[model samples]
Target chain A: MTSDRLAPQRVPIALGDRSYEILIGSGLLSLDGAWAGLPASADALIVTNTTVAPLYGAALAERLQARHRRVLTVALPDGEVHKDWTTLNRIFDALLEAGCDRKTVLYALGGGVVGDMTGFAAACYMRGVPFVQLPTTLLAQVDSSVGGKTAINHPLGKNMIGAFYQPARVLCDLDLLSTLPRRELSAGLAEIIKYGPIADPAFLDWLEASLDDLLALDVAALSHAVRRSCEIKAWVVGQDEREAGLRAILNFGHTFGHAIEAGLGYGAWLHGEAVGCGMVLAAELSARLGLIDRALVDRLRALIARAGLPVQAPRLGIHRWLELMRVDKKAEGGEIRFVLLDGLGRATMRPAPDALVAEAIEAHTAPS
Target chain B: MTSDRLAPQRVPIALGDRSYEILIGSGLLSLDGAWAGLPASADALIVTNTTVAPLYGAALAERLQARHRRVLTVALPDGEVHKDWTTLNRIFDALLEAGCDRKTVLYALGGGVVGDMTGFAAACYMRGVPFVQLPTTLLAQVDSSVGGKTAINHPLGKNMIGAFYQPARVLCDLDLLSTLPRRELSAGLAEIIKYGPIADPAFLDWLEASLDDLLALDVAALSHAVRRSCEIKAWVVGQDEREAGLRAILNFGHTFGHAIEAGLGYGAWLHGEAVGCGMVLAAELSARLGLIDRALVDRLRALIARAGLPVQAPRLGIHRWLELMRVDKKAEGGEIRFVLLDGLGRATMRPAPDALVAEAIEAHTAPS
Candidate 1:
């Protein structure tokens, strides 16, 4: 690969006043520019997880020490199960114990769970403080960390408690992804695939052509995939920060996906894995509703399975599936709204009849 | 009192798109205008304490039923002690159980404790939902409800976890104040007394003359007091929604006040009572620093005492006091910053020497 292909790329999130940049590159943790122009404060708190801390925590603290008088670290237990009030409170305790002020900056240094809890902590601590995201996992770097959607899951639903508070900046160091597990890499690829169907058909074509290279951790291919995914997400979030309308399209598969996560309980399935399977179900529902053809559903399901994601739906009972989807944030007045593909490269949110939804679920379910 | 004085006075908070009006009147809970034009939603949740639910819950539920298909009430155990994660979660449980959607509107139907927690719950649930403040106590009607400052106390400090989320509107029903305990009226008068020293001397002068009428719960005097307090707060918050610079002046006694609340444990002293005493100590510090003379300090202290608020500060050891102030949101880099008066009707935030702060504490503190 050319050196230029490995160089850092910057994507700007165009939110007025809260606008910030997502810097995607290799070896950003060591770069001085990544640490420059951050909020000037006496203290900086690094919030990460047990899984990712040992790998990169010390390096991040060393770089931050130059910018802040005190740099403290709080490594929470890894996994989505810990993404609750008890774990979130740990971040608050760390900040208050350290006497971190409102101006103190928080660095979120793990995957989605770490980024989420850290961001929510920053959002609530002293009513709000500046925070930067150092997203390491592919799913986080490509999707979750780029958007300002920060939250912790409640027992009833995933991401039920959160805020639309943007980060000061997002540093996506591709180098950190090197240590990520093989399954997580595939899980993250699911999100990259999602962008293609919902927003860009050309990107979908590229993904089909380059899926193997991306799977092999090809630097050039991974760079294009991440940059493109962030650009689409940043563009969508810019238009709808609070998910008033256009933003709903970003959750093309999340309605079913969140159901899987909540029904089986979070941590049983990685978020991206569930989203991957959920996308298949959503595409099926779209076809059943005549929004798209059956051919499109088959094509999407094939790609998800090829990417090492499950296309077969879980055996959550029909009534249970319907119940869980009803609590999805997109649901309104007890009606489950799915983000259906209007056509390839576009999406719309609407409700389908229960029988139709049940058929879609039944069509995709694995024989139990 | 004239009938015109009973008419609702609307004090608009100009926070761009988030702005809303604060309706100050005698019988606002029963008024049609108070419940009109709220966010059209399928559900409305009235979050109040046990104390308020018995009194105003049915009245509010009746008014809200006209606008919402589902009107749900969640009565939390009363008191500041319940302002924690457990209490905030009860609101979420009710919302999720009742299938409250993103468009759901929350009505905070009590005093500062209820307003703070309900506003925070709105700021969090499903990212954010609209909430209206039905502030019943004088303290909430005059200060807490108008500023968009919502929080729950952390174990380490008071209001340590929260958000700067504004309400859709604030309804200050003076009729509700008739049931307020004699001590609670004086507690609220402390906040009213605060606006004079920090922003308007004329209002302070008017308060001095009308203190008796307010103490007696005179409707005309109470209406004017609530309306004026809201207007001044609205003006300050409009300029600085977040407490960056100018907004710090609004916490003239809060640094000391928060220390007292946290030092004694939060429910020990009513928030306004602690603030009432905090103002006395803050004034003493200002005087010792030569910002104001001893006479001004004595004048303010006498007013607080006459209002039935304690002028003598709680004796939380001097070291513990400093430690608590250091954790205040205003503190930066472990240095305690106090909002001190430059002269009558104006305030500035600055750090005082430990000796001077200790001396001020000694002068006003109750003898152990």
Candidate 2:
């Protein structure tokens, strides 16, 4: 609404009283005035990883200083491997050591790993506290940072222990993505592409055409990509905040995606890459179930490859895939529930027969 | 209202779709029908403690197994001393080791420590899972189990880390009180006495009249005590489930009570014992603030003493008391917020003058 082209794009997620907004734009991390809308908090804890903190922590802290009483920065070790109980406790230790009370606000200022851990920390710090998501990666900006799914990985599974806690606000600075590595961008593109088959067909088509610009870090294309992905996720989260029914659809390929993450040991593959490959397996299973046609599967596969994501999943043994999938949060009664596309822009959750899923996995696994 | 006095009293906590009922009465633990309303799940995780498991774990498991395909029992170490992240993680470890899926139900079968840890475990397990409160201690039956404030103690504070996760149902069996040590019974009396000044003055009179029968575990007197306490707590929780405002009133004595526990190194003073003494201090503060008369404070003190609870707060030095209280869950923005009495049966939260609190502490500190 602010006709200033330099102004951020704002998307609202309506959850009644607990609603929040996702602000997408360029150079938000440096915009001091952008934080004016945050809840009146006396102190702020800026949580980021080693890599992102050195790059953006000071800038974000400087901007937040105008609003918060005190701004403290704690840079956790960089990457998904460090997302565990030990790392999570460090945040608690810092907050307690600093005498931050229940009303303190936490700022998550890095990628998905940092975002997820910070959000969970905020959720549990004093039973619950407010948090802001200042996501610095495409994957976090478009996916993890938007949904309010906060968790730390357990040795048995990824995000096995977590909370369905929402953030007070999400500031997605598209400029942050400019510093991201090429592979991580591709990884993020997988999540952006996720919106198409699950909720927005037009976004899917736009992604098909804008893949090159987005990969090249074109600002306009990247902004639109992050904006549209957030819109889809916001709508899904708004309707089903707790993933009771419709919300599970937004987790289109996450069930299989999580298995891949766990099977390979967390952080072996970036979350978005596992999801990218997971999406392919889901589409193939949908095709096998006669839920979707071969052309649609091929369309998704082609776009996935064009976006520089893995079109073929790892050759995890059938039993291993089954074992990992059974451990998913989406699962119920020991049955692995999956979100399958009824058609483009439509998703449904149901238990696919193990036999059919195994067949699809065998066909999709990369040849040894 | 089943005329068969043996039938349990059912109190419903109306949280719309997430609403649940609390069933209270004698010998309900042995009744097969008591667990019929629990969510239909293939597996159930019975989380008890070393103390309570020997007495009631097998009986509860037998009834649950009739409805669940598998019943797994995990008895954590007994006592408040074991209520920490280490013990809380044990519940998670057991759930994962059992391959318990999201649909699995958890039964917390013990006192306040077991119920708090188990409910928190359910809240964090795979984002969240359903749990039932099988409170065996009178303290839990009348207080912690009825409300959804589940948490474990942080070394820095009591109940510093946890979630407000409601259980599917709470079953309070008065029969279990038969085995309670006299000291534990007195600990529970503190919680019973709490409802008097904070919410129900009439209940205080009732407790005064029935203290002798209640101490002897008279079935009728015990049933009434549990039923009315749950009613008061349920009404409070129904209005303010998350302690946004009105709920803070429930912690009238807790600000100091928690300090007492943390100062004494948890388990040294039973939670209710700490609160018993805390209520006396809060009442004295109320009288000093001109909200209530001297007689009110004396009445509360006499009842607390008659219940065999400590009426004197540990001096712990004025600075130490303030330091411990600053870390309380109810504290916000680094200010120690205490739940104080506006008058009998009415509560308000505010900060007491440090000098006034210091004077009260000096007056109440037991000779050492």
Candidate 3:
């Protein structure tokens, strides 16, 4: 609630009683306000990935200790490869072994992979328990952390198995992103850039102008980027929590992005990286469909490349790409549905002709 | 819609948009009305257990063919033992391999295990697809099928992992119960008897009078029993879909029932049998707490025994039972909450002293 320019920014996601606030600021993790109002529990389990555990697991657990009588931490193996039933079971096993009840609160303390698995574990553990999101990566902070879309990847598809379970709160501590690898930082930017073209043209302009500051982990720029991204996502999710319509627009690049992640095997490229590359191809398709002009398509592609995302998709072969996209959750009746840009700042879900889709893939496929 | 006394009866579960109807009658599976209004999908997957698949899988698939362009059937390993992540994953594999879209409809064509697993599969597949319940067992028709409580058993507890995803519709075809084995039939009767003490004293009187007719598979007796059970369950669930309060009453025997199943290793005893024994213990505990008289406890015990269910609880050791009940979803903050009968036709969730619970167990324990 602080209005100080340097204070943490709070963006509330309106989901009725399930509604929660996202706190974005530098070092918010150590602040009491960040932990306030979360569902109280006798036991709190911190579900984080191995990569982020050593860095902040203890610190996060320390803050939670003040709220919960007993605080436990389980560090899952790092990466998208482990986002499966096996990895998910580990969380369940920990909760059960510790005798954690439905009242136990789970804290997802890593990037998208950790957040997704933890959220899903919370959703299924004893038919769901409350959970909080402590997103440490840029992509998670801006996109995955805001929406209630929690899932683990199946062998056939990325995020093929999951639930629409919302977290109790999300704390996107900007200071945590200081440790993010250069590659992952750019990947996070890809999602930050996604919000601009699909929902806010002005935000897209802001991202383009502030990409450098974000890359440098500048606190103010990171705060604005994370807060604005959450606001846009929150607005869309509020309208369609189940993705029956408006919420699907938030997945503008995900259909293509998922195909790439699945086709290459998950963890080959980070999820954000895949989405970044996929956004380029999605823009190409939008241009070919005459939904958006070529100039806009090139503009999106240029921004994606400048953000250090690959503009060229891996050569998965045209048929494989089509086959993969058809299996994307967006597809209906076996027909692949793409979230195409109707114009700058507006998105729509529709099917493109296979020939045209193939052409778009061919236009952007990396050479053999 | 038919007014004929012999016609199918519909009990609509009022869960807003997620609301669906339970059609109970003779030969409901073959009737077009039962299949009508279900979400249309290009592909339909019939998930059944090996035992039920041979008897009803093809017939159910055939009925669904009229609605779906393609019909697929998967026969899982039979029994509660198979309701685990591995068996659940088989459903996901079938959907992914068939290239099923999010719009695909899954039909659960077996008993409680099949229905629970299928509903859970539908809930998780591509983040949920519509599923219809063709519950064949009496326990399933009256309890599991009516409420949307779908789950798979974990090694630590019964139904430890699951979701509260409702089915598109539930078909409790009374004719299917004709082939049900005597033990399972008895098991199913346990759930039907459950509705009486917790919600309707009159229904309990009717069950006591009609137990023989229900056991003999008298169409009229079975129809009335199944319909009343669904009505009571639907009423309870409609008010508390997430078991925040009233819905926990439906799990009257389940807390102790689950302990028996887990103690014996899931498949050693049928879920309903365990519940039957558990109800006797629950009633004993209720009597010990003076919530109900010894006469009422004996009345419920005698009915459960006459229905061919075990009234004597298994020797799991009192401490083990206490430990298992603490992990039950109803338990909060490590305190075990039992759904006890305050009086005939009234259920209340309250914590009882450990001494009383142990005494209740001691009173009902079978000779080792």
Which structure is stronger by lDDT: 1 or 2?
Answer: 1
- Model 3 misplaced stretches (Cα beyond 4 Å): A1-5, A253-271, A277-298, A312-338, A349-368, B1-5, B253-269, B312-338, B350-368
lDDT of 1 by residue, B180-241 (tens): 99889988998889999999999988988999988988888988898888888888888888
Error of 3 at B29 (Å): 1.3
Question: What DockQ was computed for model 3?
Answer: 0.69
**Model 2, position A186: C-alpha lDDT score:** 89
lDDT (10s digit) by residue, model 2, range A165-256: 98998988877776888889889888889899998888888988988888777777877888888888888877777767898887788888
Candidate 3 lDDT tens digits, A1-368: 12234788989888777888888897687777777778997999999988899999888888888899999999999977788989899999999888787788999999888999999999998888999998898888887776688899888766789898989988888888878899999988988899899999999988889888777778898899988988998888788877788888888889999999889986798888999888988889999999999999889998898899988889998889989888666776689989999999999889999999989988887667
TM-score of chain B of each: 0.94, 0.92, 0.92
Candidate with maximal TM-score: 1
* B115-182: candidate 2 lDDT, tens digit per residue: 89998999999899999998888998988766688888777656778898899988888877778888
Winner on DockQ (2 vs 3) = 3
Q: What DockQ results do all the predictions give, each relative to the true complex?
A: 0.81, 0.67, 0.69
Pitting candidate 2 against candidate 3, the one with the higher lDDT is 3
What's the ranking of the predictions by TM-score, best on top? Answer: 1, 2, 3
Minimum summed lDDT over a 10-residue window in model 1 chain A is located at: A1-10
lDDT of 2: 0.85
